[model samples]
Target: MPAESEFTVTPYSVDGNVDYEQLLNQFGADKLTADQRKRFPDPTHPLVRREVFYAERNLDPFLAAANSGDDHALVTGRGPSGPMHIGHIFPFYFARYLQRAAGTTVYIPFSDDEKYLLKDQSIESISDHTRENLRDLLAVGFDPKRTRIVVDSADADVVYPVASALGKEITQATVDATYGDPENVGLSFYPAVQATHLLLPQLVEGRQPTLVPIAVDQDPHVRVCRDVAGKERHDVEKPGALLSKFLPSLDGPGKMSSSDDTPSILLSDDRETIREKIQTHAYSGGQTSVAKHREQGGNPDVDVAYLLLYYFFEKDDQRVQRLAQEYRDGSLLTGELKQLAAATIADFLEGHQQRREQLGPLHTELQPYRLTDEERRQALQTIGYPDDSLARQDSE
Candidate 1:
């Protein structure tokens, strides 16, 4: 394993001494507070209560909107470049929970075009992942009326024009600095698409507080979008950001990492498969021998099994703490810890799979969540071309 002492977190890379608090300082985002968490609709999500999502940018407005029964929305996106995994679904679930709790509108944008531009894949290949990812997203069971799932390529009518408007505000220098040199123009222009994704709800329904929940490294995209919203004369509010730490992968403590050798646990894994993966691959912080482990105890901080539960799967805080205490004192074995974590994660997958299996044909189920023609027109018009603003004229 590479030393964790040195790390770098960019829009495209994350490694080494993450130091999330220092990240907050560097990114100019505020740490999430307990009181702010209480403002969530109800039954506060584990991600929030446990501080998995630990920082925010201008969240007071969103909190006020959620609590005051006013207009609010959330933007959580996925880049469809590969298969869906346990780590990819948390934000979608969080968005669903918020929508259910507060009646908040949710916008989920699948950046197929961006993935195509960045990856060594064809557009057709990216489309395949998009369809597969969309299925996983649809299974999250968001309200069709309140949730909008936009495949950027499919929604280009609105996405393109709006992105053009936002693109005007992003300079090549900014793109290079935020994401490094783009291999192509499409990649260079993706920041605008990202901005459009963040601001789409407002463009469609008029200005409202929008919170974008994402990993912290992705903050630069939100920052770029916020800058456009601030600089442009458009009638929009700067989108707020809700940032999270990377979920621990089966391999180790740092964000779920996958190398050529290690593979992530796909959402399609069966219970037995999940158990085998965790037991065989999960990193352990236990002592070398049984006697030594029992005498010296295990380290939960670096134990992938314990971190997995502490991160998301284990809901009962007290129970999680007990597992940690037992591990620390050598009462809990690494195998036992792995079994517990595997079971907890598999239980989550079981419920998710049940919902997924119950899904109807993708196109049919996705229809209600797609942007309406009127919405597309309004979004396009709001950015410019008031001629198509008929859909938004009354809403104005």
Candidate 2:
């Protein structure tokens, strides 16, 4: 493991090589136990079974609820700063897997407002990204009836009021400690909005277990929200967390960034573009020369191509192991490995792009997935803002 000083992780920034185990220790999250793994639905998602999603905070309740056919939910969100990238889609896909296997309710929130506050970009730019991101999210094939997509700016009718209520529960000190000193008041107040996202399912559907499947870097957000839920003033339990390691960027390990100097394999990338990006940019763990690589096997553990396949692109367990073994034993050359990953990723993108193409205009396709009026009312009422009062005020 790298020394503690070698890495830095936070909600807004991640630098250097991350030590996931160290992160779990630092974050006070428990590693998923052996029994916890078995408790997951059969044909477990690669993220879970393979230990990509490796740690948790109070996961048992969610699992118990899932097992007993009780209401349970998964909250995984996005910040639409730009077009969606391959790294951006993992949690949604994982949520979809659980939704399919165990009837899990999925709530996807797009924090467009937060992005606008963080980036030096106009509202129009953020809005454009939000539309594009929503299309990609819709293509993930979540069940419209079982899923709700909340865009912060678009759904403020429900989001803002609840966030205003919850905002009282979070201290500015807590926000400062969690996210560092905010550049703007909007960011300082954003934690309330984030907590609102985590607790929304329970607020609307009545209190049950909700799990936030998010990257480990974002654990502080969950911690802050969990603290708010712990307060007795709210009639809600602390939302649990399923924390995952950062998806490796093509250039090397560390969180994949849309604005990175190196290119990310975007969800919209075509076959040729994906192939070119992987070939040109993916960091290789093999020897400098082909002859040297053949003489001394490559290390797939650190190879970007192998890591991508292992992480998501290649799903077959036996095949993944075989490829790793070949690379380790000098039988698989670096070029050959990159080619295989490119093709597999290209194939995956083809399907995602096709679904994206099939989508109607953003608002029309996003309609069924929006919160129902009753849902909005229930959420507001639960958060201490009765809809009748708002209605009365509007009439007055």
Candidate 3:
């Protein structure tokens, strides 16, 4: 953990090292208690069990729904500013896991409009990224019947009106405080769209619990949505959040982390590319030389290769422990550890890549996942819009 003074966690930016415990305090969210952890569908996910997903806000209801086999949902999103990466897609897999374990509906809102407003890019470029990202998302094999993929611009007939209603509750002061000064009004208004994303399932499915599993930096978005959900006129409950720590950057923990500009392992990385990137860039915690490393064992805690495996790539608990112990006891060299992580990552990517290739045309494959016409009308009507007129306009 980095010194408290050095780190900051906000909705839009995370700088320095994150103190997740302190973050729970500052964000006014609860840490995952043993009781709550037990409530998660049997076989708690590694992300939850290992505490990568560390804190939450009002998560009990969602857990209750999962345990009781009642209606519930998981809302994880994508900002298509660039290509999909390993760090970016794990949540979708986790959502799929929950869907299998608890039959939870998933709502994936792709924020192409937000990325276009924030990034220096043309609408054409943003649309291109959205299409590519959509392909990767489709390959995740979510249940099409239970999943709804909403693109902000593409689904504007539904998203825009709901956002317009929610926008009334958000003050400019709150926006500035949460996101700092917005570069433009689109950035200022994007939170309302986000609130719309978080609350849409309830509006459409009838006030069931909604869970947003996301990186903790994105908690502020949940908070804003929760706040909007609190309005008395709305028949919705505040959405819960399952917050996660940042997957470390290749450089190491608290030091270097993944970003758009940073060199990251993409979803489509070939075996050779995966090997080269991990071998060339993975930060090591072993001694300077072989003899020294044998004398002073490597520290898996600071080793990016070990962290990468432990974080998501390696699924077996015993295997990860063995690797850590081996590295710590001088039995595993930095090169060997890097190779192990690289191989694990390469295998995972190869599988995902194969799935990607196996997918059909993007639009046809995505058809089952897109929102239904009735769902759009329901969401609009729930948010105080009379869909009779709006539905006609949309159809026309």
TM-score of each: 0.95, 0.97, 0.96
The numbered model that scores best in TM-score is: 2
Positional deviation of 95 in candidate 2, in angstroms?
A: 0.6
Best by lDDT: 2
Model 1, residue pairs in steric clash? 7-15, 7-16, 249-256
Put down candidate 2 lDDT per residue, 1-396, tens digits, no spaces. Answer: 566569889988888788888888889999988799889998877888788889999999999999889999999999998988999998999999899989999999999999999999999999999999899999999999999999999899999999999999888998887888999999999999999999999999988999998899999989999999998889887999998888899888779998869999999888999999999999999999888888999999889999999988788999999999999888899999999999999999899999999998888999999999899989988988755866668989
Residue 63 in candidate 3, Cα distance off native in Å: 0.7
Q: In model 3, how large is the Cα lDDT of residue 252?
A: 69
What lDDT is obtained when candidate 1 is compared to the true structure?
A: 0.88
Q: Which ranges in model 1 have alpha carbons more than 4 Å from their true place?
A: 1-5, 258-260, 388-396
Residues 1-396 of candidate 3 have per-residue lDDT tens digits of 456667887766677666777777788988888888778887888888777888889999999889898899989999998788788989999999999999999999999999899888899999999999999999888999999999998999999999999999999998998888999999999999999999999999999999999988988999988889998989999999998888877776642334535578889889999899889887889989999899889999989899988888888889999999999889899999998899999998888888989999988999999999889889988988775965677999
Candidate ranking under lDDT, highest first, comes to: 2, 1, 3
The TM-score, computed over Cα atoms with residue i paired to residue i, of candidate 2 is: 0.97
